[model samples]
Target: MDIDAWLWWLIGAAVLGIALVITAMPELGMLAVGAVAAASVSGIFGGGAVLQVVVFAVVSTALIAVVRPVAKRQRTQRPQHATGIDALKGRQAVVLERVDGSGGRIKLAGEVWSARALDPGHAFEVGQEVDVVEIEGATAIVM
Candidate 1:
């Protein structure tokens, strides 16, 4: 039995799509789209093998050139807002108990948290407000 060029192109597109999903690579998806275009060229226009390959190469290259830079830029940009423990840092917390180098308790973000002073010599009294420097596991390092 003879297989048409379009059928082969479609098979190649399916393989490329599977590879894209397995590897999480956007480029493979682009190539798969190119393969689809090549299949269209062969099936709809009855184009020759050379023309189908040209269409595939042009589509793939164009997609990579145009989309890759935009994707890279977006990935490199930082989020506008912080979440989780990161948001807790730089926030003010009220000392519930005497907080010193060793340890103490504080009311942070409406919740009670184990806290300690940044400096061993520095201490915070009960009801006093302090800044959260960082979070170490379940404990908050304050100043």
Candidate 2:
């Protein structure tokens, strides 16, 4: 076969490989491989070499433009809002000590946490059931 035919065959093989990789593990490199394959095929078909380069450039650019926004949107759509003590709000806790206008300790979700009384002068005894009202920094507000 001619060199051009061989180049075209190589391009086809590359495209097939890229498609398989994308099907198995859709990653950014697959887009680059596809663009290279397209450009190689364009070159082997006797299209202007500049045209082949332009085709590759345009394809890669468009793929990046389309994929980035979709990936970003998907990432943003999943919520990762609350963690640790932040997740304790609205849950019941057991006060371990009295919050003497400062802070005390409480047992929540099987873990001990620093807690403060939302209402001043509201004394809590050990094992007293309290509601977790809010979390500020490293402390939880109890009621």
Candidate 3:
């Protein structure tokens, strides 16, 4: 068979293998597939050493540009619910345990989290409704 045909087959196989491996191990699969595709395409169509280098560079650049944004978007989407303590401000919560002026625990979205009072002398008892007023570092300030 022609070298071109063999190269195409290799590329196809690499892509298919990537798809399979992605289901079980996505990181390794992505790297293997990208390398295979770049090598196969460059080996087939590149006319000389310089052309091969250029083709590989272009393909690698394109892959980085395309894959990076997609990966970033996926990561952003998964963690979009709430992030830094600032995100908790103004949200309502219930005291999970008694809170003195210092610190205590509260329940937010069915999850118990560390909390502190925003105002001095404020005390919250277990099961009492509280509103998130501010965030100080990793702690939520409740009223």
Candidate 4:
């Protein structure tokens, strides 16, 4: 039985399209587009198998080369604002315990928190206002 080259390219395009839908990767979508281009070249343009493959390779590679870096750059960029515990930094807290560098507790952001002094040997007395310098796990580093 003889199978047409265009039929194979059509099948490849369909398989790649299905994979793109399932994976939700733009790269897979781009490859499926390349397969479709190859199918069109072979079926409509009556291109040889080698020419179809060259079109597929060039289109797929160009898409990856141009798009992947922009995607990577978007992923690597930092968010504009701090969130969660990061937002607690530099906020004021009321000392709930005699806070020393080793360990203590405080009322931070209206919640009770484990706290410690920013400087060793420095301490915060109860009822005194202190600033949260940073959060280390469950503990707040304060000054």
What is candidate 4's lDDT per residue for 14-102, written digit by digit as tens? Answer: 89889888888889878887888888899899999899999999988998899999999999998878889988998999998899989
- Per-residue error (Å), model 1, residue 64: 3.3
Tell me the deviation in Å of residue 17 in model 2. 15
lDDT of model 2, residue 55: 66
Residue-by-residue lDDT tens digits, candidate 3, 1-143: 45653365356557757676657644444444555655665566555545544555565567667887898788778565666665677889999888767899998767788898877697999989999887776677888
Candidate lDDT values, in order? 0.97, 0.72, 0.70, 0.90
Question: Alpha-carbon error at 12 in model 4, in Å?
Answer: 0.8
Worst 10 residues of 4 by lDDT: 28-37
Q: Rank the candidates by lDDT, best first.
A: 1, 4, 2, 3
Q: What is the TM-score of each candidate against the true structure?
A: 0.73, 0.52, 0.40, 0.61
Query: How far in Å is the alpha carbon of 54 misplaced in model 1?
Result: 1.2
What does the lDDT read for residue 5 in candidate 1? 97
- Per-residue lDDT for 1-143 in model 2, tens only? 45653365356557756766767544445455545656565655656656656666676577667877897798788567777656778999998877644899998898888998998788788888999999898788988
Write model 1 residue lDDT over 16-118, tens digit each, in one string. Answer: 9999999999999999999999999999999999999999999999999999999999999988899999999999999999999999999999999999999
Q: In angstroms, how far off is 91's CA in candidate 4?
A: 4.0
Q: What is the number of residue pairs that collide in model 3?
A: 0
In Å, residue 23's CA in model 1 sits off its true spot by: 5.3
